[model samples]
Each structure stands twice: as C-alpha cells, then as structure tokens.
Target chain A: MLREDVTEAIRAAVFEELAAVGFARMSIEGIARRAGVGKTAVYRRWKSKLSLVLDLLTAFAVEGLPAPATGSLYGDVRALLEVAAHALRHPVASQVIPDLLVEAARHPEITEAVRATLLDSQRGVVAQVVRDAVERGELARGADADRALDLVVGPLYWRLVVVRDARLPEGYLDDLAHASVAALRA
Target chain B: MLREDVTEAIRAAVFEELAAVGFARMSIEGIARRAGVGKTAVYRRWKSKLSLVLDLLTAFAVEGLPAPATGSLYGDVRALLEVAAHALRHPVASQVIPDLLVEAARHPEITEAVRATLLDSQRGVVAQVVRDAVERGELARGADADRALDLVVGPLYWRLVVVRDARLPEGYLDDLAHASVAALRA
Candidate 1:
C-alpha cells in the first residue's frame, strides 16, 4: 500500500534523525521534512513521538542481525556476539539505540516491543544454537541456554552500556564464547 | 558553609523527586519547591539537571548491604546475590536507581561516579568473596573472578532494568548464584 510505504519512509527518516539528534531532541517536524511529507501525514501515522520512535526503533534495532551457524557451537556463539557487537557499533545502533532503550524503561509499550523485537529475537537465536549443541552432546541437557547466552552478551553490554566503554577489545568475544561453552558443558 | 548546606538540601530534594517522578519529568524547580529552597540554589550548585541528578545519584546510590561470611563458597555467593536482589527490590531502590543508571549512560561524569559508587563497590564485594572461595579451593585458582561476578549480577540487573519485572521470585537468587559458580567451575 502507498500508505505503508509512506509510513516506512517516515519511520526511516525518524530513525535517521534519532541517530543524529537523540531521543530528547528528535522533532516531528524534522522527520516530516526529511520524509518529504507534511506534519499531518506524520501525525496520522503515529499517535505520538514515543509511538513513532518505538515503531522506528523496533524495525531498525533488531532486524537483519541473524546469528551465524558456524557448524561448531563455539564458533557460532562467538560469531553471533562478534556480529552483534559490530552492529551495535554502527552509527544508528551506537548513538540513538541506547537512548531509545533507556527511555523505553519509562514507556511500557515501547519497552515490550523493543524486548520482543531486539532482546528476545537475539535470545531466540542463542537458544537455537544451544539446542543444537545439546542435541550434539556438547552442552548438558539441563543447561539453561538463556543463561548461557546472557553469559556471552551480558558482559559486552555491561562494558558498553553500563560501563560505557568505547568498544570490546581484541579476543574478548572469543574468550567469552570459549569460557561460556566450557562453563555449560555436560 | 551555608552554600554546602544548600547544595546538600537541593541534592537530597532531587533524590526524593527522582524516586517520586523519575528523570524524564524531574525538574530543578520541583526539586527547589520540594526542598523549600529557591531555584537559584540548585542553579548555583550544578550546571544542568543532568549534573544535579548525577551528583545526587552518586551520593545516594552507594548503598552497602551486608554480605554473609559463610565459609562455603556457594553459600557466600548465594548470600551476596540475595542481598543485592533484595536491595534492588526495595521500593526506593527499584524506582529511584534505574533512572540514575539510564542518565549515567548519557553523561560521562555520571557514568564514572556510578562505576566508583555502585559497580566498583559491587565488584569489590564479589572479588572478596571469590578470593575467599579460591583460597578455600572452592573455585579453581584459574577461575575468572570478574566474569563470574558479572554472571551473577548481570541477570539480576537485566531482569530488573530490561524486563522491568517487579517481583524476583523465591529461589531465583539461589539458582543464579549456584549456576554462576558452577559455570565458572566448569
């Protein structure tokens, strides 16, 4: 539908603007201008800036980052985090995504959508990899895949988001992947 | 000094308001009104609302809960997470501290203060306990104390901040603590 395309265009523009200006300073007028649409057109698509930004974030935050199937569970796990860390360093992922995540805590609907779109999807990938590992007798039957996934992803996020480091250092992902796999073995 | 007293009052008032309204809606004027001081008092002390909030957050967030000195490594780990988890569940801790954490990500000064006050403090506790465990041969000397600590704390914070789950169920702390220790040992 033309309307759907217009909505996508406006959301794409909003995501770009959010990357540039952040959540607090992102303006509806600016998004409309960038999308080549009127203010009313933008307003008709989203009820509020929060909803608009939420939709944009949902689309852009988690899409296109699929976990690798590297045959070896360890390789697959490391590849997953390596790709995710690199993606998070992308301009949009780096700059505005954190702002949206922090703000989402305050807005319940946005928080839920981001969780479904961003966290769980990534988590689901990790779970499948772990399931494969379990089937292959690499990981124990009782091993909590989600917890194992957290072991790999959590520290990077802790360092990046909580500790606010510039980037993960060389071999950090590999170290985490190896250690986490060893930790979860039968 | 009279200036110091006023600063303290403004900081305390800001803390109360943050617990009450959160960072998005919190205002210098509201802090002043709550503190029974003029807006100028807050302005004279801090450059921006972020600065003011960060200062207050740094001061108030360094809560040192008790850690049991149980001889067993598992018991000590269990006790530590239990204490941290319960502290997080405390009404004030849940409502007030997360906003500071979110704000800390946006501001460098705040992030450093948080590292010093909250993260480092927790790390110290974990390190001390892990050292005990290593000395007792409960954990292998090669165990990465820091990563093990992160394993325990990360899931709790992820649930609290990301999932926004108010109730941390019974035995959750024990499960995480045991799993973290086991993960490291494995």
Candidate 2:
C-alpha cells in the first residue's frame, strides 16, 4: 500500500476496533491486524492508542461539524441539530461515542483532549452562531447565549446517546429549534 | 455471614467493581471476590451480570427520583433538576451510568431495562408534574409537556454526564429552570 493508504487503513481499523471491542479491550496488535499492516506502522504514526483515538475522533468531529450560516437563530440551530442527528445516527458513531465517553471518565488525558478539541470547538461554533443572532437583534445582548447551546444540543444527545429509545418525533429538530430560539429570546 | 449481610456486600461490590474496572471488564467472580463471598452467593441472587446490574440500577433510580410536587411548573422542574443533579454527582453513578449506557448500545436487554426502568419512570414523573401545571392553568392544556421534560433533563445530563467539564456556574440550575419554563410558555 502507498503511504497514504497505509495511514488510511490504520485510521479505518482504529474505528473498526473501537466499534468491535471498545477502547479498554482494544490493542495495537488488534488494530494492526485489522488494518493488514504491521504494528510498527501503527506505532510510527501514533505513540499510543489514546493518541490514535484522540487524533481520529478530533478529525472526525471537526470534519462532521459544518457551521451553519443560515442567517437566523432558528435556522442555524435547526441546521446544526440536523447535522448532529445525522452523525449520531451513524452505526459507528452510535456504538463508539458512548464507549469513548465511558473511557474518557477514567482517563484524564482523553478528557482534556476531548474537552479542548471537540467540546471547545463546538462551543466556539455555537458562540459564533449566537453572536450573529445578537448582532441581528434577533437575540438580546444580555440573553443566555452560551446556555442556549446546551439547550439546543442537550436534547439530541439525551435521546440519541443516553436514552436510546429513539422517541424522536417527526420534525423534532424543527420543534426543538423553535423552542431554543424562543427560550434564548426570553 | 447472614443472608442480608451477603446481599448488601454484593450490592456494594457491584458499584466498587464498576468504579474500578467498568462494566465491560466486570464479572461475577470479580464481584464475588470483592464482596468476600462465594460465587454461589452471587449467582443465587441473580442469573447474570446484566440482571444483577439491571435490578440494582432500577432500585437506585427509583430511590433517587422523588417526583417533586411543588404545584407549579417552575418549582417542579427546578426540584427535579436538583434531585437529578445530586444523583449524577454521586461517584458510583458518575462512573456506572456511562458504562451501562455504552453496554446498552451493544446489549438489547440492557437497553430495554434501562429504558423501561429509568428513562420511562423519569418521563412518567415529568408527565405528572406537567399534568398538574396544565390543570392549574399555569401551562396551556395543549402545550408540549413531553418536549419540556427533554429540555429540563437534557442539559443536566449533558453537563453532568457527557461534558463533565463542570462549567456549571453558581446558578446554572436556576437559569436553566427559568429558561425551561419560559420555553414551555412560549
């Protein structure tokens, strides 16, 4: 395999391993075997599984989160929710996220990396969206814009990840978006 | 040892094992060893680790949830958030909830038990609170009560469980409760 192909193979295998056995049981040898490469190839790119998973998850999250410039608070929140809903519904994500969350609780390294990269980046995006709304006078200057992000993102996480009952009503995002904006305005 | 003492020891050991190793690595033998009891004592009470965890989790959840009856939407929602916040902050619950959620994704049996016992019961409590508010004319009869429960509970779960960064401000719950009530009113 070419150098890029080898890297890609390792990346794909990392997620496959995570989906198959979870983070605690996952090993470098297992990832290498699934990738059809030597363990040296995996080690050369990343020093450890924590770093490997960290890098890939950061990349996946950044790639998946496309900030919406929908020009309205409701539009932006709804669009973000739609994108989030789609990503959470993916088979790999459905399995891998909760597993990683469980692992992150025990490992402070993973916790900091996830916080700095994934959580902070998403918060930044939400801040930007809220700023735009405030500037447009759609939201008040003293409103809880940061708190609104939690309100918008929280329900999606609650239903998809924790509850898993999937009682997502039709047009759920639409209703959620409407409520979120109304709440922020108040 | 007396039968009650053995049962209590086993119950305590389950949380300890979960805190130490997590659900994926937890075992009946390990729990028995931790509890200082024979395997038979553990097996006699529960058929499998899943059933054992399920029964304990159901009891824990039921005991933790008190169903606030403050007779007002804001009062009830805030009370619920307070109880939930206190429960989520417990060390054992902080460790065990995500582990079970992760395992639940893989095991349909766990999913059903968690949903039936934990999620449904909480939702039921929220429904009762909303029904009281609607009857008292604090909320409209046709308002979205179910969605309000998601808004109320979601942020608490998101911050305490998923984010775990502890950005929870001094008056976070107060602000959230106010916003939740406002959103439902809107």
* Top candidate by DockQ: 2
- lDDT for A120 in candidate 1 is 76
lDDT of 1 by residue, B73-109 (tens): 7888788877777766764456555555555545557
In candidate 2 the C-alpha lDDT for residue A20 amounts to 81
lDDT of 2: 0.80
DockQ of each: 0.31, 0.68
In candidate 1, which residue pairs clash?
none
Error of 1 at B105 (Å): 5.6
- What lDDT score belongs to each candidate, Candidate 1 first? 0.69, 0.80
User: Best candidate, TM-score-wise?
Assistant: 2
Per-residue lDDT over B36-115 for candidate 2, one digit per residue giving the tens place of the 0 to 100 score = 99999999999999889988877776653556889788999899888878877876556787777777767867777767
Candidate 1 whole-model C-alpha lDDT, 0 to 1: 0.69
Q: Any runs in candidate 2 off by more than 4 Å, and if so which?
A: A61-66, A91-93, A142-145, B64-66
